[model samples]
Target: MAFFNREDIDNFDKIHRINLMNSLSGYKSANLLGSISPEGQENVAVFSSVVHLGSTPPVLGFILRPTTVPRNTYENLKETGFYTINHITQTIAEDAHHTSAKYDKGISEFEMTSLTPEYKNGFLAPFVQESPVQIGMKYLEEYYIKANDTIMVVGEIQFFYVKDEMLQEDGFLNLSKGRVATINGLDGYAIPNLFTRYEYQRPKKIENSI
Candidate 1:
């Protein structure tokens, strides 16, 4: 058996861990980048770390640093309870990376990324029109971690839009042709391959079919 100690793991430091995490995109799930804008003008950061927490009641979440660095996203979500999850596809990867340029307030990153902001259902948070899939979220809870200042944000999914072709008859993601995007780090994005797919019910009867 192989074992590893949490502290003994050499890549445990923040910078090292973050860099190590960058390598996980190739193996783990890829997610959309999310951002929040106060009054629709704050050019905040773009995060590739967004994740879907659930579909029942539709939960979504992301992690953010807890520093007092004046994060516009935290403020916007706090004030408006609204944000946009923009899928980062292969084509828009460069622009998505550009969104992290640390722009000042009132500067629209959209102006430079060529991604038009979109609004739906009278909600003002604008998602990227180019995304094959986009979702609107409302903040629900914020939980803190003791070891670090990072916080986990939970939000409710209010609206979702996806390309018609991306859903199969079974209503699951047709990843084989979703034309979606995934990230590897601060600057890597790609559509991964389709490997084997199978039902995951375990504790099975033995068979020699193979």
Candidate 2:
């Protein structure tokens, strides 16, 4: 196997280095983050960093690029204190990917892409109509990671709009059954299939093998 230290990685070609670093961590969840500006303009952006922070209060977090350029997602969430995370399914993968293109500050990605944005049940933020699983969130806090110049935004889940059949008896949503897709590297899209489920392990006395 090839080994690379910090210096070796840093010397790689620009795009090549990016792909290596981004993919090194393996596949990441792909979701469409929906937000609305204070001016009532809607915005949706494709994000791969969405991760579960906790379950007690149902908190979720995602990383954002530095505020040096136009950051509609972070700005809109700060302005309105509400956002939505919608799973990217295989059916809408192409449209969802297009949302990442940089657009004008007031331009809505929903208008530019084939993805439809819907405001549900009085929620302040819009949700992707094409997503089978949608989560409404309220902005809670943000921490600036000076080491990377990126910000981590945390939010509390306010509600969820998931298809009833997709939910399992143990409260786990069968994501693969919904055909949700995960991201590889920066732009590769893939749909994972259900393989096998393992039961919780329990310790038991066993004879030693020498």
lDDT of 1 by residue, 123-204 (tens): 6677787788887888899889778779898999888888888777877776546666666665666787677668868897
* TM-score of model 2 vs. true structure: 0.95
TM-scores of all candidate predictions against the true structure: 0.81, 0.95
Stretches of candidate 2 exceeding 4 Å from the true structure: 204-210
lDDT of 2 by residue, 75-176 (tens): 899989999999999999999999999999878999998899898799999999999999999999999999989999999999999988789999888998
Q: What's the lDDT of the predicted structure labeled candidate 1?
A: 0.71
Clashing pairs in model 2, backbone N/Cα/C closer than 3 A: none
Worst 10 residues of 2 by lDDT: 163-172
lDDT for 96 in candidate 1 is 69
Give the per-residue Cα lDDT of candidate 2 at 83: 96
Best by lDDT: 2
| Model 1 residue 103 CA deviation in Å | 0.7
Q: Per the 3 Å backbone cut-off, how many clashing residue pairs does candidate 1 have?
A: 0
